[model samples]
Target: MTFRTRFAPSPTGPLHLGHAYSALIAAQEARAHGGEFLLRIEDIDQSRSRTHWEDQIYDDLAWLGLSWPRPVMRQSERTKAYARAVAQLTDAGLTYPCICRRADIEAAAGAPQEGVPQFGPDGRIYPGTCRARVFPESQDHAIRLNMAKAVEGLTELSFVEKGALFAGAHRLDAARLVETIGDIILVRKGMAASYHLAVVVDDAEQGITQVTRGADLWEATQIHVLLQRLLGLSTPDYHHHDLIRDDAGKRLAKRDDARAIATYRADGATPEDVIEMVGLTP
Candidate 1:
């Protein structure tokens, strides 16, 4: 199989050093292996995703001396595909409508009898208050995967981590996924699909053979692997690298205007200079 990878950026804000690092790493990996590198616009959050940002993404990537295959995949346009996946999950009895909101789930998860509050991949673990309930058709609610039920007959899981430090086919810590990443959301009531659902679907559709990203998303890989299994999609090998930090010892954010790629370029920084800034150049 061709070792394909992507530099998917959510067109919500300006691209920062962190974004550049991830994109360059993925592009380099694809080039090193004589594979394809694609660019995906993850504009699932329509409210925050702007046309200006999308335009800026193209400008910045081109300025960085990178290019991808034509007809870039945008998550917003792939709602129909995501909807079909959700429908399949609904048919398999692995999903249930979640009526509990963030506050409600947090309160329930933090209840005294609920034991030491365990946080999952999505931050706090969902308390599953609506797991067993049968809500009316008119009820607006998110759809959550039943973690325990989802892994019912599955055997022990393992995935390849091709990062610098965590390389090889590593066995999954099932206990941690069970305890920390329980009942993840697939689709919100008003939204077409959540990140977990849409990303897995997009990766599979794009034939992403290798997923290169930051280590911050390591735990999220567990959920992605599970979804790939459940959906019968090919699981891609992952490369989670170290994150680029700012002077404050914090991860770079899009909101950090000073660190935005556009700002640097406006200040007469070249593509090679930016690459060096992110330590991508030797």
Candidate 2:
């Protein structure tokens, strides 16, 4: 492996401390191992993604003493590729239209099971309300992967994890994926594809040999595994690193503008301050 890694962030808002830590660690890892470090703009959500935020991302990373090659990858320009992946799954009988609303899926997932919340990588496990419906393209519906069928179609699956706690390789069970992940969104209404699908496709296309991200995405790897298998893509080594939290122990979010890298710079905080804040330096 070439130890390739990336720091992909959606340009919906300014880069926060959490984003900085992940980016810094990924770049450091690639450098330490003599590998390539890539930056990707996950700006597929055109409705929310802003060019100003993208510009801030560059400034933030540069201030943190990170550099990358020219021509960074942007998800917005790769819709056609994502569409082809979606079409493959749909034609292979592994995907169906999902027209259920969030409220509807929540109600169904919690139907008659109080106090036992159903959750997936993105929060609630979709109840698969429209998994069986073969709706017309004229109807407004998102495409969802048929987890049950998709898992059965694949043989034994596994992935590598480099996190300190769960370090080493990990094996994926087909039955657990169907049970825990349920059916996940592939393509949204009038969009290219969901984050799960786009990421799975993008990583392979980018030749990313190592995925260094937050531990919050560990569970989502199961869903990505299914997509990788379905699309015949190569799986990469995953390094789910620790998350950066505030004094109150809450994880940082894009809405936490006070913790934004740009804000810190304006407040007289140096790059060393950020490195120290994230405990990446002594």
Candidate 3:
């Protein structure tokens, strides 16, 4: 199969130094391996997604001297596809509708127990209060994966990591997943699909052979792998690179306008300068 990778960005804010580094890295790796680099617009959150911000993403990436094929994939247009995947999982009894709000989850979890993880990649691991509840037809609700059911009968789960720090074969403990990352959200209350579900389905549809992103997301890889297996989809190799942080050591976020690519470009910085700033060759 031809090597393929993608740089998927949410068009809710400016592209900062971190975004530049990720996009450049993926593009560079694609060239090095004679593969194809693709761009994806993760605009699933329509409330925050803006046309101006989406246009800026294109301008910023192009200004950095990176190129991808036209008619790029956008998450906004893939709701039907996401819905179909959710239906398949639901039909297999691996999913349930949840009406628990953040406050509800916190209250249900109560105090943190000894040796029990309270937080996970999906944030405050779900308490499974609604796991046994039937889907309410008239009430708005989110969809959650039935973690125990999803991992049933699985002997072992593992994935290959080609990152700089943790480069090796990694295995996941099924029992641990049930304790920590319990019943992650497959679809949010008002969204078509949550990041976990949409990403897994999108990667499979794009035929992405490799996934390149920041190391901060390493913890979430196991979730994606499990989803791939449950959906009968292919799991791509992953490259989790280091993140770009500010002087204070905090990772750059969209709010860091000073580190935004547009800011650097306006201050007379060239594409080569931006590339070098991210520790990449021009």
- For all the candidates, what are their Cα RMSDs to the real structure? 1.6, 1.6, 0.9
Question: Which is superior by TM-score, 1 or 2?
Answer: 1
Clashing pairs in 1: 120-180
1-282 in candidate 2: lDDT tens per residue?
677999999999999999999999999889888999999999888999999999999999999999998799999999999999988988988888888888787677655466443776856778778876776778898888888888875777888898795698788888777666778889887678899999999999889999999988888988887789889998888999999998899999999999999999999999999999888972
As for lDDT, the candidate ahead, 1 or 3, is 3
The TM-scores, one per candidate, come to 0.96, 0.95, 0.98
What's the residue-level lDDT of 212 in candidate 1? 92
| Cα error, candidate 1, residue 55 (Å) | 0.6
Residue-level error in angstroms, candidate 1, position 222: 0.5
lDDT of 1: 0.89
lDDT of 3 by residue, 136-227 (tens): 57899999999999999986688898878789989888998898899999999899999999999999999999999999999999999999
Worst 10 residues of 1 by lDDT: 109-118
Q: Judged by lDDT relative to the true structure, which candidate is superior, 2 or 3?
A: 3
Quick one: ranking by lDDT, best first? 3, 1, 2
